[model samples]
Target: MKSSRIGRIPIPLNNVHVNAGDPFQVTGPLGVLTLTVPSVIKIKLYQTMIKVTPVFSNQRASAIQGTVRTLISNMVAGVTVGFRKVLVLNGVGFRVSIRNNILTLSLGYSHPIIYCVNRNIKLHLISPSELEVFGVDKQLVGQTSADIKRFHPIEPYKGKGIRFINETVNLKERTKKK
Candidate 1:
C-alpha cells in the first residue's frame, strides 16, 4: 500500500464548494477552479474534512484517485492563499520597471529589454533591484522567473546578474599564470 496515497485536505472557507457526482467548484482570492471525479473514485467533503478513495482494485487507479484529490486540494489552497516569487537584481545598472503591463529591464545592457506581462500573472517592482511575481499557477510563476533570469544570468566571476533570492551562484576560481 502507498502510504502517501492516503491523506486529508482542508478546505478553506473562501475557496471550496461541494457538489454532486464528486464534482467541486472552488473560488478564492486568487481565482477559481473546478474538478470532476469518475465513478471509480469516491470523495466525501464534510464541514472541514475531505476524504478520497478509489473503488477499483488496481494500484494505478488508486494512485490516480489520490493525485486528483491532491491537485484539487492544492488548487483550493492556492486560490485562497496565493503564491509569490521574489527575484533580486545583482549588478550595476540592473534595474526593472513596470508600465502599462510591460516590464522594462536594464540589466547592464546597452538597450532596455521589455517583456509583456501575461494576463494570468501579476508582476510588481518592489524596488529597482527587487521584483515580486504572483500567480495562481505555479508553473507560470516559475517560467516567468526563468525568463527574467535568462535576460541576465548570474555570472560566476562576480556573481553579477539577476537570480532568485534563494539561489546560489558557483563562482569560478581565477587561474594563475605559470
Candidate 2:
C-alpha cells in the first residue's frame, strides 16, 4: 500500500491540548473545537505533537488518514490562532455597515440588504467598501464571507461587486458596434 504524504506530516501543538477519543477535542486559549475521528484512522496525542495513522493498509484507509489529519490540524490552528476573512466591495454607491448585530449592505440596488450576524462570528467594517469577518472556526469564517459575497457577485462586464480581499475579477470587454 502506498503511504499517505499528508498523513506523514506531524502537527505540532503549541499550547493546545488534544484529547483523543471517539470525538477528538482540541482546547486552546481562544476556543475549543471537537471533531469526530474516522474509524479507519488512529489518532495519537503526545506532549507536543499529534500523529494520525491509518489502521489498515488500504486505499480508502489512506484517504481517510490524510483527511483526518487535515481536519485535526485545522481544529488545532483554529482554537489557537483563530481565522479571519476580509471582503471588499467595488462599485459606485456600494457600501457596507454593521450595527446592533445586523449587517446592512447597499449594493446599488433599490432595496438594502441586511444580514444577521452569527453569535460565533464577529463582523467589522473597516471602511464603506471593506468588511472583515472573524471566528475561531475556519469553515464559519469562510461561509460567512461567501454568504455576503453571494448578494452581489462580481459582474464580468463592470467588475462591480463584493469579493474577497485576495480575489481578482477579470472584466470582459464591452461589445463594439459599427
Candidate 3:
C-alpha cells in the first residue's frame, strides 16, 4: 500500500495553541479555528510541531491522513497570519464605497448593490474600484470575495465587472462596423 507523502511532512506549529480532541481546535492571535479530525488518522501535537499518522494501513486512511494534515495546517495558518483577497472593478462608472460595515457598489446598475460585511471578515475599500477582503478563515475570505464578485462578474465583451486582482480577462474582439 502506498503511504501519503504529504502526510509524512511535519507541520511546524508557531505560537498557536492546539487542542487534540474530537474536533481539533487551534487558537492564535488572529482567531480560532476548529476542524473535525477523522478517526482513521491520529494527530500528535507537540510543543513546536504536529504529526499526522494513519491508524490503519489503507488507501482511505492514507488519503485522509494527508487531507487532515493539510486542513490542520490551514487552520493554524488562518489563525496566525490570516488570509486576504483583493477585488478590482473595471467599468466606466464602476465604483465602491463602505459605510457602517455596509458595502455599496455602483456597477452601472440603476440601484446600488449593498453587501453587509460579515462579522468575522473585514472589508476594505482601497479605492473607488478596488476592495479587499480579510478573514482568519481562508474559506470565508474566498467565499465572501466570490459572493461580492458575483454581483458584477467580468463580461467577455467589455471585461466590465468585478474580478480578482490577479485574474486576467480575455476581452472578446468587436466586429468591424460595416
Number of the top-ranking candidate, with TM-score as the measure? 2
- lDDT by residue for model 1 (1-178), tens: 4423443344335445555353566666778666777776776667765677667667676777768677766776768776689999999888899988789999877899999978888998888899998987666788988898899888989999999989888999988899
> How high is the lDDT of residue 62 in model 2?
92
Model 3 global lDDT (CA atoms, 0 to 1):
0.91
Point out where model 2 deviates above 4 Å: none
Candidate 1 residue-wise lDDT at 155:
91
TM-score of each: 0.80, 0.95, 0.94
User: Clashes per prediction?
Assistant: 0, 0, 0
lDDT, candidate 2, residue 87?
98
Winning model by lDDT: 3
Worst 10 residues of 1 by lDDT: 3-12
| lDDT per residue as tens, model 3, 1-178 | 7769999899999989998987889999998899888788899878899999999999999999889888888899999999999999999999999988899999999999999988999988888899999999888899999999999889999899999999999989999998
Candidate 3 wrongly placed segments (more than 4 Å):
none
Off by over 4 Å in 1: 1-15, 18-24, 35-42
What are the root-mean-square deviations of the candidates from the true structure over C-alphas?
2.9, 1.1, 1.3
Q: Clashing residue pairs in candidate 2, if any?
A: none
User: How much lDDT does each candidate structure score?
Assistant: 0.76, 0.90, 0.91
